[model samples]
Target: MAGRVLRPVGVITETARRLSGANLHERIGLKAPPGELKRLADTFDGMLDRMENLVGAQRRFAANAAHELRTPLAVQRAAAEIGLAGDPPPEKVARIRTRLIGVADSSEHLIESLLLLAVSEEGLEHTSPVDLAALAATELAAAEPGAGPAGPPQDPTVVRGLAPLTVAGDGTLLGHLVRNLLANAVRHNRPGGRLELSTSADGVLRVSNTGPVIDPADVPRLLEPFRRSAERRHTAGEGAGLGLSIVASIARAHGARLAAEANPGPEGGLTVRVRFPLPEGPTPAPDSIRLPRN
Candidate 1:
């Protein structure tokens, strides 16, 4: 009787001791009658399942990050090598220099995005009141500094359907959320497509634009790090595929709801909506709080 009770405990202990990254697929999978020890073994198996999933996610993120960071570095190295080879002419040198600068700038943007994503994942330490409507209008109105010769001319027709809306969160992260939404919308749009955004006092911000057709099933995956939609690859000079993922992380940090849907029209596009929680209390009248005009 004593041996029978101790047998499962000993087995679980031994199995746990032998577990490692290479063996996450292994399970205790003990066969026993229903009781406290049986319950314990089942719980242990469940914990290992979660651990396996978490470890797998970290591994994937690391690989993707490495690959993304490597691309710009490789470009920089190749440009430098060409410049130094055989004493290049002044014009060629200048072009090489310019290319290097552009690659460096791209690297900087990627790093900044990675840092913001990291900060968002750690959760917010403090909170402040941020007006979603004003941020959307400001970002929508601002010129696209990223638009170089090869980039889009920000040509999409813009419509402002904003209302004064406020939510509690880090204002910077919230601003990035709006900026990224607008940028993603604009970058993937058609030449004469229409861009629209609206903010409601009820804590919802929505941006929609016209672009290439996308599968509805890919929407969720697009929110993951480095995931890009096949249809939306028209903008080759656009982003490192971190735009929507950062938005998703910031939304999670702020305890907000975020959704992206592919447009059903003939001209394909995406509509991303973020819903933040409104603070408890009556919202002040529009006249009471000064907001940015569209």
Candidate 2:
């Protein structure tokens, strides 16, 4: 058999193009400049880099979440096994029960953290307009540690906005956002420490507590999932390192902004300020939309 061999041909264009026609031969064509190929290659490279970072972040988040859950889960299982094996002394049983409660509480906390994260990631499409001042007040009331045996009065700093400023986002998630900030502040503060929260007319909310200064270097790192500063880890109470990360995620989801700084006041500590950009113009009252009451 006789065959004819043809050499490869080159084609170039100023811009990308695609052509379609009834005939199969003319159905498809794309035009591009010489450098377009290189530009495309660069774009592919950038996408790969972004994908790598996303995958790394996901792996790290999963590992850290597992580690955080394992401690409480292990304790809960052990406590259950002990109870099932035999009936211990009343005192011993009570201690085991107490330990089990702590484990259960930790589990609940983990679930709450996961829920908050999921909701924030889902974006604010489902959220209605929210009044930050009212939301903050409600969160503060619910976040109180409750009265001590002495019945010490608990007063949270409250700031009422000039008008009912509304933000388009999930109120429950925003409440969690506020609560997380307040909880972290209260939990990490010194004994008898002071907490102050303020809401500006421009939809900015600030929460500050008196405690040790957060090292400047650790500020950004603290916002990563499951990351806790060495100084923060020394403070009282069990923190799963999800606090500021949740705050950051919520802010991003809602197009809100968050700011943090070290307070120079005598009652020095880290201050976190979340500034929510007010929706343009008058905020129409949401019809039949309500946030979950804490």
Candidate 3:
């Protein structure tokens, strides 16, 4: 019979280590009375339960917020339409239209944030087979006119995906993620700055923009809710800063990796790289083949 010899971990009790796991060294192995050890274990379980409850509450709040905003936006938009049609002075109508636009924009932002949170929290409900290259092209096309370079437009760059290039994730959330990245780039860029977006076969999508340099220290903080750089805070059309955060959260939930870095340019700015999880195995057969024309 082989007798187990447990090495004493600093500040740990021999009995507790045996109880937790023979091969384990943990803070919970601290010397304590038998009753106290049981109490500590109980406390740990209680904390985990509390954490789960808190997460549930947050999800409910997101769902509720999304549900609540839809009605108000509809009502506000209708009222604005009526106001526009009626006999209001040009000056007054202009003011009214501007204020209404602000309201509508605010409401829309709120709804979008809530919906993004809800979809990410719910887990895989709104997902479908998505082509990152196609999505990026579509998103770029849909951006506001005069957003990027002017004159005769250049053709969009495309990266070939290995397979159906499909991943199971919410299409809306993904689109929002792409849109936010593009919008952020365009809004913060220097005049005539370059924007590049590409998707790879290895399940990575990258968006890069040329703009003023963001401080290295600001990268992590940039994703926090309502946190924006001082430079961007005063900028026109600045968002709540949930855009990148939402992208990060959704990436995490989908078991993907989200990375940020400074892009290479005369005036460096932020570049976001998101690596989505590839479905196990190779690209679909039809998608993988290069056909010969008849």
Candidate 4:
């Protein structure tokens, strides 16, 4: 009996040593005879599967980060090269200046987004009761910079919120989540399009925007880092495609559920809803927060 048990252990040790040289992306599962050794083998195989998935995700994230960073750097380099080539006329100089400034702005936004994503992955540093409705109102009042000037002159957002709708989470991260959602909605909207933001006392936050019709299948991809719709790709300064992904990350950190769907109509759109669980204690006072009706 001792030899049988010891044999399985010996085999597992040798197999592990042999496979240790394999890359993280490679999955080499172990097989064992029926009995206690089989259970150990199954557990080891499950662990290998998890490690593979984690490594795969990290690899994709690294590749996407490099690609996103390269674009802005390339723009800046080209602008510098053009400016250095010769003494340009006033109009050309002004154009170069504008291009450089735009590149700088985009780079800054990308860096900020990356930092937020990294910090969120590590987990929230602080936690408190945050009023989602009031936070949304504040973000709405302040127009997001660098969203491009393509939309209609008039603001198109409709806000319907219940006061004192709060959740226990890090204020900074929660605020970021709200701002990202709002910015995304405004940036993607068409000229004279409509945006609806609503928050309920039950800890539900919904942001819906009118834009080009999106395929239902594409909605999931939109929540991944560095994923953008074809239309958004053409629109300069829209964003680095990290808005919804960061929002999703922040929501996960706060234990909230995020649901995204494409709106149904001739002019299609997207709607994202985040449902946060209420705190365990007493609730705050009720106050209605409404934006000016369109």
Q: Which candidate number has the best lDDT? A: 1
Tell me the spans in candidate 3 whose CA falls farther than 4 Å from its real position.
1-93, 144-164, 231-235, 264-266, 282-294
Clashes of each: 0, 1, 1, 0
lDDT values for all models: 0.86, 0.70, 0.66, 0.80
Q: How well does candidate 1 score on lDDT at residue 16?
A: 97
Judged by TM-score relative to the true structure, which candidate is superior, 2 or 3?
2
| Deviation from native of the Cα of residue 79 in model 4, angstroms | 1.8
Error of 4 at 125 (Å): 2.7
Per-prediction TM-score, please? Answer: 0.83, 0.72, 0.61, 0.82
Q: Give the TM-score of candidate 4.
A: 0.82
Report per-prediction Cα RMSD to one decimal.
Answer: 7.5, 11.6, 10.5, 8.6
**Candidate 4, number of clashes:** 0
Runs off by more than 4 Å, candidate 1: 1-13, 30-43, 143-154, 231-236, 282-294
Kindly report which residue stretches of model 2 are placed more than 4 angstroms away from their true locations once superposed.
Answer: 1-45, 80-87, 145-164, 231-236, 264-268, 282-294
Regions of candidate 4 where Cα sits further than 4 Å from its true position: 1-15, 18-22, 25-39, 144-159, 231-235, 282-294
Q: Report the Cα lDDT for candidate 1.
A: 0.86
lDDT of 4 at 46: 78
Better of 3 and 4 by lDDT: 4
Per-residue lDDT value at 279 in model 4: 73
Give the per-residue lDDT of model 4 (tens digit) for 212-275: 8999999998998888877337347457788999999999999899999999997678999999
Ranking by TM-score: 1, 4, 2, 3
How high a TM-score does candidate 1 get?
0.83
